[model samples]
Target: MAAVETVRGLVELTRPVNVIAASVLTFIGSFVAGGVTAYPLQTGAAVAATGLAVGAGNAINDYFDREIDRINQPERAIPRGAVSPRGALVFSVVLFAMAVGFAVTLPVVAIAIAGINLLALVAYTEYFKGLPGLGNALVAYLVGSTFLFGAAAVGEVGPAVVLAVLAAIATLTREIVKDVEDLEGDLEEGLNTLPIAVGERRALVIATGLLAVGVAASPIPYLLGYFGAAYLVVVVPADAIMLYGVARSFDDPTAGQVQLKYGMFLAALAFIIGRGALEFGGV
Candidate 1:
């Protein structure tokens, strides 16, 4: 039973849904941007490596923030005694090593990007969590790396690079809103999150502005003749709904599960759009 509990704890630590979402977004971007044809093996390895890295990063975060989790997330595996901190750290290290090893097999660009991501994850866990807007920016940047990784996987960097930029904008908006929703827990743990430092109302305003830009930009690929109408038709409503979620966040952050729900929605929509465009040769 003890061993089983430990396994379960590790599973929870991975946050499988989040891992899948990250991996899928990278997979979609790579497939759409011509990776499967150019470098299928490398692309598959990169995606697997990214998932491991993300999982490890999350575990490391929990390990480092054990004290804070004890307060803000007492029911979390480590804090609840389902997993030992030392054990978690070891697991995290192993995953990180695997991810790095896989990344090293790819192009030099992928290796460099993986190094940067590793560094950022460490910095975020070690010190940035207590910073203000800096923490938010770091999280957004890491999230943006998923789409960029796809581009790098195929040895092409222009189109996927643009998509990555757009992803960053959307991610930053959602991150700020999450800060608001988690404000209470973060404050109790003495985290200097944007919502705690600047207040919810102000954070909402900033998040709203960023989300507006992201939503409007969602149509740009179609307009630029890069993607077909599929992207436009699917993404417009998706972006609008996300924007609605952002607006609703102002009144009640908890009510705005859109931050989480719509991120996956957009990611799925992107995959569909990309596939549709490719199949029909419309774009």
Candidate 2:
């Protein structure tokens, strides 16, 4: 009981799991660029910056989206009274400040990426959320940028670019599915999300097509001699899972989106395994 109630107590607004995952992406980027071991300070700073930035983004998004969540996701921290909008905004600002501080310790390229991401996070809810497909694209880019930021922190940002593109496409799929899931609430709020603008079926179809493209290109890293056999082993199943999730989205959007995220996470793990094995195990 204590473990479930106390130890498991976590802040929903910050989306801690996603924060951690973004940090992993930063580390993976550095690793892929072959500078993670050599540039410890830069790698660590990049990871820290990515995590804090993701947290700040999530909190501020929730702060600005309180009204929408009150209808779409009443159980969310802001809508459920667990966290006030003002408090969330303040917390987001603090996190953003910390992220910037860490980012400033890195190279100029990483700092530039962080600055752009910070501005995007701040503007996403107010300026982009209502636009058809654009909001999803912005969020997708943010998710993928973690890898680029990490790679830039260490040195070259080439290898991670492919990973970023794949991640972005997968994230785009999930975002469209989520928009479809929230169609009713979004409609009530007069928000013109992708599903709202393109219609649910068409939106899901687009998302599926995007995911298919991503899956088809998932082997680019291996073919380019960036990763090894382990990557192929893991990515094959990950691609299958993502394909299924997108297909299922047409029927059960909520479940489909959740599954898509799980698959995406698995795909991310495959990248780490693929690269680590190639570098260390000679696999």
Predicted structure with the largest lDDT when compared to the true one: 2
Candidates in order, TM-scores: namely 0.94, 0.95
Give the best candidate by TM-score. 2
Q: Pairing residues by index, what is the TM-score of model 2?
A: 0.95
Please report how far candidate 1 places residue 254 from its true position, in Å: 2.4
Q: Rate the local accuracy (lDDT) of all candidates.
A: 0.78, 0.90
lDDT tens digits, residues 1-283, model 2?
Answer: 5333321222577899899988998899999999888999999999998988899899898888888888988888777666667878888899899999999998888889999999999999999999999999999999999999989999889999999999999999999999999999899989999988889999999999999999999999999989988999999999999999999998899999988988998998899899988998988
Question: What lDDT does model 2 reach?
Answer: 0.90
Over 4 Å off, model 1 = none
